[model samples]
Target chain A: MVKLKSNDDKEFEVEEAAVIQSEMIKNMIEDGCATSVIPLPNIDSKTLIKVIEYLNKHINMGKAAETGEEDDLKEFDEQFVNMGWEELFDVIMAANYLNIHELMELCCQSAADRLKNKSVRAVREMLKITNDLTEEEEQEIINDAPWAFEGPEIDDTVN
Target chain B: MEYGLIFLLINNQKLEIPQIILKSHPLQSKIVPKLTYNSNSCKTSSNTSVDKKVEEKSFATAEVATLMAPQIPSNESLPKLPQELITAILVRLPVKSLLQFKSVSKEWFALISSSVNGLIFYRIWFNSLVLWNPSTGKYKQLPDLMPTQMVTTGYCFNYGFGYDEVHNDYKIVALFREIRKHCVGAKIYSLKSDSWRILDDAQGEMLYDGSGKLVNGKLHWVTIVDGGWSIMSIDMVDEKCRKVEQPCYGVDQFSLTLGSVGK
Candidate 1:
């Protein structure tokens, strides 16, 4: 078993096979730094739990594909990332810090999917990003490519 | 004991005790950094003022224990990720979303504009010409040269599309002859400015065969003048129309097609 200690001091006992999904943890284990509990100062307990759940579920990914469980794994992944924006952001950061390639790809794809076809205002509100451009600068950008803004697929209102 | 068991059940079912309690834990307080947008700086400052507020708020409610709810981090807690992470996410986004979100920040605007690599030319509805970038899926349509009146009047016009490397622009050259006046005229449409302008010096009695070839930043067309075929070339850079002498073929009396034998 591999022990992971969250920033909150909460300790999680995870299987070595499951925990090794994280490249950072795998490297630490190889270098003998994982003799004790691996400290993850960048991730909180709640986020760490979510990441552990993902690692556990995806541990047998290769066997799942051979046994035709790929669809089930894909479905689990789809439901796994169904989180609020703040929660999703935490997961993305945690995945990045852990160097979990698949989790990073999945979370980034989720972020991109949420942003697809959304208007400038909606994207700003969704991401909680403040638009710092001046009115003239904004207008100039709009004028430079007015056709991009004319498509019917664009959603102007914030959800 | 029965009442205590019921309370534990309620807490487990409704609040998920471990998750909620973890929020108030001391080490968890430092997990997320504070994000502040400064107008003058136009950048996010890592000053821990907002982080301190979160720590104090979480710690102040720690004594309440079971009664305290899980603290959902505010939007400002969204990590100010590194540039590479932001790029990874942005690159996966569709072109339309990228274009619309260009106004989100100066950095995003620069990223999207700089990532545009190539242009694709296509025609829509057989008449509307467009310049598109397949990688980005962003396209701009060129203005229509033939108006409704010209179409209804059944006037014939020849067109050639070529690029002007000097100005970094695409241009469409049109050659036409007035039916009643028998006067030939030429006009050029610039994709950069999205406008058309007539070439003032393009006045002649030349008869074009309605086909044009674009080569070497110029438009070439075969025209018959005084019962003989000659090559007419338009210099897109200078917007001038001039005739080129055809090679001697011993007066063989045959039609010629204008083509470029690659240099």
Candidate 2:
């Protein structure tokens, strides 16, 4: 078992097979450097638990094709990324910090999919970004490509 | 835990690895510089209680979590996402959404503009070609082809645009057929010099007037050569026309069109 202590000082025990899915931890183990508990200063306990769940679920990924569990894995991934943007952001940061390539890709794609058809105003509100463009600049952007803003699929509501 | 130890022993072939690297490895030295021997003595009292309170709520829906995440006390308030993470998200967005996001902020405008890597080529009218980069908001209209009148009314007005990495230039290749004279003419436009030159060696009776498919630094077109439909390609570097070997399809279908998928 590999012990991982999150920034919140809460420690969780993960199987070596599951925890090695993280490239950083894998490298540490391979280098014979993971003798003691691994401290993940950038990851909180909640995000660490989420990442551990993903790692444990994905431990048999290599055997999934032979065992006919691809659908189960796919469904798990879909449910995994269905969390809120803030939670997704935390997961993304943890994934990045842990150097988990697949987790990073999945979370980033989810983030993009949510923001895909959002209107400028919706995106600004979601990110809490104040629009710095002047009226003329905004007009110029709309004038440059009027069709972009006229699409029926553009959503104004923030999730 | 016994299985994990056995797996590690079998993989590494060294059971003494733990003792040899203990307390001296980079994971201990670099990551946790203030490494303390007493794990039970570290900062855990207040944080564990706070985590328990948050955990009792269970997982909420995305909308509810978005409303609630900010309210939960963070040990370290969420930092602004790094630029690379933002760029990764922005690149996945479709072109239309990206354009709409230009008004979000000056930082966003610059990021979105820089994220756009390719140009858009379209014909507004007969023989009038415009190359536009929506990111940079720069566009150039090609000068009228020398045989604009003849090519405009021609039966075949096939064209293709692609970047030439060799010369670091953007080029447009067009094949025009004069129905009246039964003549096929080809022209190549160079964005670097802002000029067009006649491709005198381009030879083929085009099967259709559709645009050529750009692939592997070449513009490919379907043409009729000696009563058989063949694939012809123009090398963007040498500006020479060549025939590509066609796949062995049952020699019955005549309608052959050229198209490419992926980058």
Candidate 3:
């Protein structure tokens, strides 16, 4: 076990093999520099726990690694991202910062899934963003081409 | 997704997608919802500059991959390369790997998409299968075609592809059918145009003899055509698709060599 301190001064214990999945941490360990509590100023405990969970699952399943029936494992990872959108974003941000390649990929693909079947309005709402392009600019972009919305009735959809 | 579908149809030779379909799509970064009929949102943005964007996108990518990635020389191996390097690497990869890598990124989704079609890709055979080109880096999805006895297994299948040296046009042909009725005609794909079109089948010729092979400048396939089975050849150069009759003597009786009869 290794002790780690989060950004908010919370201390947590993580299994050595699991935490080492972070190549960043693995490099630190190989350098013989991780003897004491490793402090992670960038990651919060909430996101760190999730990352640790993933690493742990991966290592524990080193059992069925060869059969490659990792689909069930992949499904669990997918369900893990089924949280509220804000949490997903937080995890994604943390994953990117921590350089957890698998976690980063999972979050990006999840982000892609959210964008899959949404409308422009829903997209804006989901991302909590307003159009940066001006109304005139939006119209100008829409004016030059109209087939994109050629046959849709948006108002009737909600009503 | 309109542009995505257009790019796909362009390869399909489904009438040229109206430019409007491409003009209204948002970037992969910008995701809009499923398209409906009341798309007042889709107007504007004439994509006269689309070709320019494609050229510029290619240039910008090559610039990043070739110009930027190696120059920096970071101490740690970088996780990602410029999109252009990825595309170049993707184009060189076999279809199997590309299919798996397609799940990597949204940009990769757009880049590796089979939606935008123009490159001459694989030819279709019987049984919901298509012959694919690994060279250009795209796989074509052929419509569900009923299979014959010969092509039930993959080994019986063969693909004939080459450049017509006389005309400098490239062609792709796939043949695998047990019976003449089921034998698909040679489907011609041109590199310059990057589209597939059905060539006139060699009329009254059997297409399922030993299988079609590309030798010299013509396509050679065995057919149980005519009253009996015969070897047939098509000269892509002259657009002449005709049958070549087997000689007077049995092929085994003498050392019969296959030769082109005409110029």
Candidate 4:
């Protein structure tokens, strides 16, 4: 078993096979630094819990296809990332910190999907990002490439 | 009481507590609920510090975040992403979406317009053409140059699209036979000027058999003139038409087609 300690002092016990899915943890185990609880000063308890759940679920990823559980695993992954933007960002950070490749890809893809096909205003609202450009500056940008702004195929509203 | 005391001792000592004592603590369930609340408060306080560290780390190096933890943005209400993460998301978006969202901010506009993202062209319905940039999701439709009367005349048209390096423009060349007059006419459309100009010098008693092939700022077509096969090429730079002589004398005209060998 591997014990992971989150930033807020919460400890989680997970199987060695499952925890080894994290490249960072695997490296520590190889270096003999994993003898004690692995301290993750960057990840909080909530995000750590989410990361551990993902690691445990995807432990035997290679055997999933042979066992006919590929569709089930895909469904689980699809449902796993159905989180708010903030939570998704947290998961992305946690996954990056833990060096969990699959989780990082899943969260990043989810972030991209949410921003896809959204209008400028819609994207701004979704990300809660303020428009830092002045009206004239924005107009000049549109004028510089008028055809990019004139397409009828783009949606003006958020999806 | 023992578990609570041990937690206080660990906090004071800043030392790692053994996993066995944590798991064996009888009041672990009660302690977890209180810890959850404490962690929530701790998150709020540490978020800003963590964000600052992430910003410093990201700015200090241009390296990929391998083992180092990426800086999470501190603004909890708004999930403001770093420039690198935003680029990661932008590259995955379809070209159309990238174009529409270009007006979101100056950074996005610069990223989409930058030359790192190459342009792609797609032909729609054989009559109109759309040029798309996959990185920006932006597309521009070229103006239709084909006349309405030509569509119903049943005349076969051959088209050649190429870039003119000398003029720094894209040109679409169309050759169509005037069935009534038994003559062929060539028309060139310049994307820069957004207009088509007829090449009056190209009128000839020749038949264009297949599509034009573009090579080295020129368009080549197989033509049958006076029952003899010859290759006709148009130089996009000077807008001049010239015929390339057959490599061999008296080779059967039926077996010849215009093709490029190598660069």
Candidate 5:
């Protein structure tokens, strides 16, 4: 077993085989190995837990036959990420920190799900980003530089 | 309880990608300094939060060319905009940017690919649809589009999109190419009718690739014509493909130019 400690003094234990999903852990195991504990100084308890779940699920993807439970678990993931904005954000961050590729794609797809059909003002508001453009800058974006805002994927008729 | 590894996005701010968090991500041991999400944001937004409205405009394509992305931290902060607002912003970007933004965060990418929101964004894509009402003196971005015909045929996507607010409806014109070896045609789709609309006027030509502009609800493009492959255009609203009439006083016919005409 491998034990990962987060910054907030939370400890998570995972099977040694599953822990190797992490490239860092994989290398450590291959290089004549790890012993007592793995220190994940940047991750919190909650985020670390999420990472473990992803690794476990990923490590089991190929065992779907005898397990007969991989698809169902994936459904759980679909529902799991369907949380509110703040929770989803944290999950995304955690997935990135842990280098969980599948979880990152899944979470990103989830976040993208929430942001369809909004205005520039709404996008600024939702993403917590300021316009940061001077009046000229703003005008230039909304005005002179109409080319920049043109989305080739979007039609002109609806707006 | 088990959970995913987290990358914290302080305050839901775009520029709030804390340095400590980056150094601690799961891949940090492998790719710390090489990642440029924060540095890229610095180049774009100068580490300012989207909370207080800044008075600056965004960087132009020429100034802010996109680069290949580094590793992603799944826990990065998300934009606080509602689903619709985010879709609006996505609609304004080129498909390439939308594709890139999908990697920045999971939420954004999902919305871009969602059936409804993706549909809306697909409707008003390419360049901004600047429909000058002249009457209201105000304009708003249109919603994205859906590929009605592509979904119906269960075929892969071959489509185009635009808004027709003038007709009191959002318009989407999707194209589906024929599979026959000797013959070819395009099928169109519209959001207003929520059904597949077919078009036989493609001239078996593809001018949709050019930088076309929509003015007064008509689409125009600078493309090659039939005789010599010169500048050509097609009105999405009317489906009338026409060649641009260039100046004819001994000017070079090969030198065709197309630009936006403001009303």
Candidate 6:
């Protein structure tokens, strides 16, 4: 078993097989650097819980095809990324810190899919991003592709 | 993280064009060099110009980075992702979405444009061609082909871009056919000389009209030879077209398309 401590001073126990899926932790284990509880300063307890759930479910991923559980794993992944923007961002950061390749791809792809049809205003609002471009600069970008900026297909609702 | 290594044989000898590993993870720094600009030959005038432009642009990046540093959210508010994490998300978006999202912010505008590796050869219309490098903010408009304006209802035009290792130049190959006159022609444009020439010795009829795939110092295409589709490659060195052995796919009903992966 491997013990992981989140930034909120919460510690959780996980199986070695499951935790080893994280390349960062795996490397530490290989180098005898993970003797005690592994500290994750960047991830909070809530996000760490979510990541642990993912790692547990994705354990023995190579044997999933043989066991006919590939569809189950796929469905779990589909449901996993169906999170709010803020929550998804947390998961992405956690995945990056842990160096979990599949989770990072899943979260990033979900984020991209959500932002695919969103208008610039909707995107800024959803992510709470402050647009630092001057009006003239913004106008220049719009002028280059005026049709792209004002299309009916562009989604305006912030999800 | 799956690593891929693709091997190619050129002139009956192994030729490895640098390892093109796609390190998309935010933590790992991407090491893949841009194939559009080979870094080895720094003495070339165009190469030196590109280096100067990149240096200037990187200086601008540092200022932008400092300007963006404070805007990042701390512990209280919604956690804002780091710049690299944002880049990981943006790279997966479609081009249409990227175009719309360019107005999101100044950083987004720069990120979307500068994500391109090097030169992007794009065709606006049938006749007009453009080569743009977003990082350097440089663009060049190629001379419009008069024959493209002559494209009628039934005729088609195919174009391809690739690097010629032997001459150390970039080349754009264009194949066009005029149905009314029953004439087929091919043209090659060299970036070194900034000129175009019609290939007099090119067997345009046998050479299929399609986008050429650059692999191992050659541009490959599917050709119709004796009523059967066969693989044909054009040597970048001599500009000579030669037949290549096609992959043995047991089923003849499958359609064939040429594509190149890695740098």
Measured by TM-score, the strongest candidate is 6
Clashes of each: 0, 0, 28, 3, 106, 0
Docking class of 4: incorrect
lDDT score, candidate 4: 0.56
Name the runs in model 3 displaced over 4 angstroms. A67-69, A150-159, B1-263
Native interface contact recovery, model 3? 0.00
lDDT of all the models against the reference?
0.58, 0.59, 0.44, 0.56, 0.41, 0.59
Task: Say which docking band candidate 6 falls in.
Answer: acceptable
Residue A44 CA error for candidate 3 (Å)?
A: 1.5
Prediction 1 global C-alpha lDDT: 0.58
RMSD of 2: 27.1
For residues B1-263, could you state the per-residue lDDT of candidate 2 as single tens digits? 00000000011122111110001111111110111111111112112332232223222212232210112121233445543456557656677887688667755654443210133323211334555443334445567766455532323355777667689777888776543222567889888888888887774453332456667888887665544556788888888888898766543533353434324
lDDT of 1 by residue, A1-159 (tens): 999999999999999999988766775676566787877766899999999999999999999989999999999999999998878888987886676768987998888888878888888787777666678778876765577677888886764
- In model 4, how many backbone clashes occur? 3
Q: What digit string (tens of lDDT, one per residue) describes model 2 on residues A36-154?
A: 88887768999999999999999999899899999999999999999976788899877766767679778987888888899988987777766666787778767666788887899
Candidate 2's displacement at residue A75, Å, is 1.4
lDDT of 2 at B223: 62
Residue A32, model 5: Cα distance from true site in angstroms: 4.1
TM-score of chain B of 4: 0.49
What TM value does model 2 have? Answer: 0.49
Point out where model 4 deviates above 4 Å: A145-159, B1-76, B110-263
- Residue B101 of model 6, lDDT score: 80
Model number with the top DockQ: 6
User: Candidate 1, residues B4-78: lDDT per residue as tens digits?
Assistant: 000011101121111100011111112221121111010111112322332343334334321211222333656
Q: If you assessed candidate 1 against the hidden native complex, which CAPRI class would it receive?
A: incorrect
Clashing pairs in 4: B54-B71, B95-B137, B96-B137
Clashing pairs in 2: none
True contacts kept of each: 0.59, 0.55, 0.00, 0.53, 0.06, 0.65
Q: After best superposition, candidate 3 residue A26: deviation in angstroms?
A: 1.5
Give residue A122's lDDT in candidate 4 (0 to 100): 79
For residues A1-159, write the lDDT of model 6, one tens digit per residue.
999999999999999999988766775676576788987766899999999999999998889999999999999999988888889999987887676768887898799888988988899888887776678777877776667776678899989
